[model samples]
Target: MKLSSGTIRLIIPAASLALLLAAVFYMQPRAMSYTGLNLLFNLAIPIALATIAQMLIMSINDLDLSMGTFVSFCACVAATVLQTSPLLGALIFIGAIAVYAGMGMLIHVRDLPSIVVTLGMSFVWGGLAVLLLPSPGGTAPTWARAIMTAKPPLVPMAIIASILIAAVTHYIVMRSSFGVLMRGTGGNDRSVERAGWSVIGIRAATYALAGLFAIFAGIALVGLTTSADANIALRYTLLSIAGVILGGGEFVGGKVSPIGAVIGALTLTLAGSFLSFMRISPDWQIGAQGAILIVVLALRLALNRLEKREKHQ
Candidate 1:
């Protein structure tokens, strides 16, 4: 029996993850253990959070070109201001979230392209990050470092965190009434407005939520690394988008899967580990990852076509 396109979309990410994981195990047999798994996946926690943030923006059919830079700015704040004065840092983060919400309102009210607005914000964020930590030597907060290093029973913190994020985001994006309105705003803002809801308000709220998640991503990254750099999360912009699409999210539609995005982030982390195990040079890793991701997308798209044809038959 042929699978439906929706089923195929759900299966592709898991299958890619399994295949990549098997490849990793084959390359480094020692990585089969819990310790090994933890080592390989620890970095993925932040990435998964970032992907969720991106998915939130995509839910409204908007792209955030500022994601990476904003995350870097937050990491800088976490390492310096947060570590030194918790209250100050908390206020700053709140302000940042408000700024993000304002950006959404600006985009909606002015009929501006989200890309352009976020792109300008990217420069602003990057500049702020540089001002915060010019030399990349700030320390992570003691509490954050402790939490990142914690070894829980039954599984590593990375896996546990990813699973929890998946579950929470799934409920928020797929189950909640507010989530329905948020997504509907993306699918058809006119309908949402006609229904007597404020499209601007929904968009603003969604952007604020994305900012919250992005802040978490930055904090988690700084925790794992024990330090912060202005350029630390600069690559996350493209990486988060890739993870979202890998997890069956579309660019223009309100269609997205939180669980799939989490798995996709994990898969990306494993892919990086697999490459390292294969002894690929560090300089080539990014390009190599792109090639691997392309192959996975091609296969998934081919399967999706087949499934659609089957449905018509």
Candidate 2:
């Protein structure tokens, strides 16, 4: 039976989720009872934030390779401020994210290629993180740790928070004029500019959004770990992008479903969980994620080609 595109998309996610649950039940029934929920929340929240950050940048035909660096820097800085007061540290964390956003905006305004500029900015941010903490051994406040680790009854606060953030973002991107313009700008910056809109401004906005999302990821990491380190954001750079692409973000050059990205993030986390629970070596996970990404990317390319062929026919 032939399947509609919508049906196919639905099937992918449903199948993925079912397999994940099956693996958990098969491999770690006992441990899954106690910490399974926490582990899933832990993985989903950070990946969701990272995917959102990548999605925002992709909305304007840009990418933020500096996400990892920004996350590490922000978290490390937050740790320092938390040393004094958790409240004050949260404030500083937001401020630091704004600083990164401003830097990205300035780069866009100056007509620098987003990838190149962000790559450089990553190093600069990493250096700043190193200077601030030198390594990853700083204590987060008791309040921060509690917020990150606690699992409230009847409502997984972390999961609820993730859903809320995703919903708000989806609403803004789908229902607002800014969203329309971003989708337009992402499709073709030159055409958008010719229509009398400032591509610079739009691109700057995208970068700012990306930076804000990265800050969210940073805070989540700090909450989970109760400590800050310079290398904290490194892996997220690839993982977030992989999540975005896997979730159909590449269909329109990055204007993807925030929900889909969340689902993709969950899938990745689940995959890792399944592997680890099965006593799969850590090295295998790296290889497995890469293979999964390659398969997704190839599928995207094939779909694009088919679409193009149909248009010509």
Best by TM-score: 1
Q: What are the RMSDs of all candidates, in order?
A: 1.4, 3.4
TM-score on alpha carbons, each prediction = 0.97, 0.84
- How well is each residue in 41-126 modelled by candidate 1, as lDDT tens digits? 99999999999999999999999989999999999999999999999999999999999999989999999999999999999999
lDDT of each: 0.92, 0.73
Evaluate residue 269 in candidate 2 and report its C-alpha lDDT on the 0 to 100 scale. Answer: 76
Span of 10 residues, lowest total lDDT, candidate 2: 5-14
Q: Please give the lDDT score at residue 277 for candidate 1.
A: 90
